[model samples]
Target: MAMTHLQPDPSPYPADAFAAFELLSSAILVIDDDGLIRYANAPAEDLFEVSVRQLYAVQAGDLFRDGEQLRQSLEEARRHLFADKRQILEIDRLGREPTQVSVTVVALDGQPWPALIELREIEQQLKVDREERLLEQAQANRELLRNLAHEIKNPLGGLRGAAQLLEAELSDPALIEYTQVIIQEADRLQTLVDRLLVPHRAPRIVGDVNIHEVCERVRSLVLAEYPNGLRIVRDYDAAIPEFRGDKAQLIQAVLNVVRNAAEALSARIAAGDAEITLRTRVARQVTLAKQRFRLALELHVMDNGPGIPPELLDRIFHPLVSGREGGSGLGLTLTQTFVQQHEGVIECDSRPGLTDFRLLLPLP
Candidate 1:
């Protein structure tokens, strides 16, 4: 059925009567008691990915995969028409890869039975909810890994001690050598277990942290590694506000990104052309981890080096994935986890001669 359009009659109300509807974050539609769509806002066009004229050609139920459920919701809204409450409904879209949407219905005055429908894309909300759950799961896994590592360590120590005792008592040279091999292998296993437990240890979160302090700490540490070859530069915006967070964890997070950049710049450093810049600024009206905020802190680490390999770029944040040979590959993953704990996001861009890592953190 073709959608019926409702052009408002000129009245004494303000010229911007539709302003509230246009500014709403939800996709909105106006309908009469007959259930014909009278109007839709910009968010409505975005929700359906169609122009107003195109959207007006179809019935409200036609947009949903499960039309019956939408009809039921509409009926429910009519039953409680003017109760001063919002009626929410969830529906699936009618398409190959169906998307979910949540809608709210409210009655509007100045008509016999005019109703307004507000729609929200639930797919993005679902993705955010999934990631939050994954983060929680990752934390749980870290705790389990820590306990398992400690349990393994106790047995490893006993095995190493037993091997040492056996090597001392053995009279045959070959048997004594085998016992020494057992002790060495146990020591190697212990080291691996310690590495596994590192992320699980609780960080001490205290003090009002000036992000510049964290950047400087990372800068000093990186320069200490390549004192003469690498040059660390700062481009700080002193007006950035202080945010409450775990100082040590923030330092480690910055250290990992900066140190990785320093490592990538090793060859250029040797050639006396290496440069790493640490920049900080305040971003307004930022969104991270699906939540929108009025302001945020943006810290960027940029380097002049052979950029990350294209093939390894996507998986850089995955555990055990690295661009450098012999790299343990846990640094970026740990950095992501730490920044996420602080309700922030880390993104990277790389080319042949330049690579940049940007961290966006909300101001608390």
Candidate 2:
């Protein structure tokens, strides 16, 4: 159904009636007793992706994908139940993905409007909750990996020593070669175990860090490696100030991200159209690591790769969770650890032809 072209009559209330609603972060809707939306606030316009003109006179129930529950709640309100009630609802925007919103119905008593509706994006709240869970999970993973690595290290040393002694006792060259293989494989396992233990060791080294310089260093290193078919683009903001962090670790973190992107773009690289963009901007009044900062920096690493697989995207930061074959999968886990050490967060967004890894860090 199309929105009715009916206009609101303002004579029943003060001229500044909706002024307070525009200031609120919550999306608000003023509905008449007929259940038609009389007015929608700025936040409502944004949340619904519709203008006030379009929402005006539209039945409030029509906005939701399944709004029968909403209609009942409104009926309850019109019967003089002025108590506020809240429930979750899904809104299907035209040609856009459906959005989940927490809706609260507040019944108005003997006023210009019969009801007031409030909408809040539940996904945004879930993101904050998910970040907290991720931080806790990462810490526990570090402790577990550290203990496991240490336990394996001692036995691995003894096993390699026994293999060497066995080789010394063997006179036949063929038998000695078998012992050498055992020793070589043992050393390889030891190296992998040490890498697993590295995150638990080496405290974060902190100093004045220029983010742009870090990006430049990683850019040069990556370009040197993929000089033939890949390109690294820089779109940086000069306003980002220096922050106290481990410059080396930050470089490693960026390098890991860029290198991963390059690897994912191997197909595109062979096609001679591979590209990775390093874009930076200053983020103001942002939240990271459960703390709100007046200023933060956003570093976006974008690539024209095929993108991460759907199954591996969520677990990309987990140890040994690489998407590519023969991949150790520790790159992103260590990158996450390094970024978290500086009170930052890294998240990825991907589709078929594009992938973006965004890192946010607080600034001094």
Best by lDDT: 2
Worst 10 residues of 1 by lDDT: 84-93
Candidate 1: segments with Cα more than 4 A from true spot: 1-155, 171-181
Which digits, one per residue and each the tens of the lDDT, describe model 2 over residues 32-54?
A: 78888877887687778777888
- What is the per-residue lDDT of model 1 for residues 1-364, given as tens digits with 9 covering 90 to 100? 2234534443333556557776554678866555656567776776676677766525676666655665565665666644333333444333635556766677655644456677776775564565566566556656666787799999999999999988888899999889988988998888778777666667666668899999989888888888887888999999998988889989999999998998888899889989999999997545566666667999999999989999988678776678888888778878888888888888788998889999989996
Every candidate's lDDT: 0.76, 0.87
**Candidate 1 whole-model C-alpha lDDT, 0 to 1:** 0.76
- Each model's TM-score? 0.63, 0.71
Cα RMSD, model 1: 9.3
